[model samples]
Target: MGGIVPMRDAGRTGTLPATSDELSRLLTVVRRGRVLTVTGRFREPRSRLVREIARRLSSNFCDGAAVVAIGRPFGVRELTAALGCVPGMPFLPYGTADAVSWLAERDMLLVLDGAEHLAPEALAWLRRLLTAAPGLRILASGRSPLAFEGERVHRL
Candidate 1:
């Protein structure tokens, strides 16, 4: 949609090419839900497709969109670092509280691409983020769902 967004690669997996119908469905779900997972094996085109969706729909969000490429061994630290990269966020020290506070006031689309594997603590962190940031919407691409209270999964 724009310039190449830098991506962090997880271990390689097959590509699942995206179709316009799939894109439309995903977009619809994102608009209605707080969190969505495009579930597929690692290294598929899920991240690319999610980024495209973010680009297309970011304008609907007040603070716009940020796509974070989640790499292997995903954890709270990585999550915090990724969130810090969102435009205008202060330089955040590695901590969950900082992230939660910062995002609490913003409206944005946060796309976590390549989140196929998340440890329990990381999941907890995401839960806290969702609970605190009322205006934040997450579109994640992974092999499995985050299983939050209102998560919507689109299996690829």
Candidate 2:
């Protein structure tokens, strides 16, 4: 489920191993409409590895998947923009349950990144999303489990 894909370093002139075969396998699972959750430390300042992984997944799922990256320092705008997010401010209102519910109905893959930093709120949101959106599949990357029933975990 994993292969060494070429990734670029920001300040260097070489490639590195950025993602695991496990990530590839997980992407496949997402393609097949299964929820894929990942737990680990995420360092930003986009590396070639991250870009490559995103590229592969985007190519495969395209309109059928969407990624939700939640973290402190909230660089979500940057990442989502990079992923070609359509221009709209859905997360502008804090704790808006209605907005969250609306987002959950889209037939897209969800990527919940950096949930470790916002465990309580993020987990609650995930739980609600899971319950509200039957067609939604989640791919979460955090340091711990959201602990919702039926979640499949992959550790890195």
Per-candidate RMSD vs. true structure? 4.9, 7.5
lDDT of model 2 at residue 84? 42
Candidate with top lDDT is: 1
lDDT of 1: 0.74
Name the lDDT of candidate 2.
Answer: 0.49
Q: In model 2, which residue pairs have backbone atoms overlapping below 3 Å?
A: 1-21, 2-21, 65-109
Model 1, runs deviating above 4 Å: 1-16
TM-score of each: 0.81, 0.58
Instruction: Kindly list the per-residue Cα lDDT of model 2 for residues 1-156, writing each as its tens digit.
Output: 111122222124345343566557655666674455565554342232333344467545433434444445333333333234432323323343654566555555555555455435545655666678666666655666657677777654
Clashing pairs in 1: none
Model 2: how far is 90 from its true place, Å?
7.6
The superposed Cα distance between candidate 1 and the true structure at residue 147, in angstroms, equals 1.2
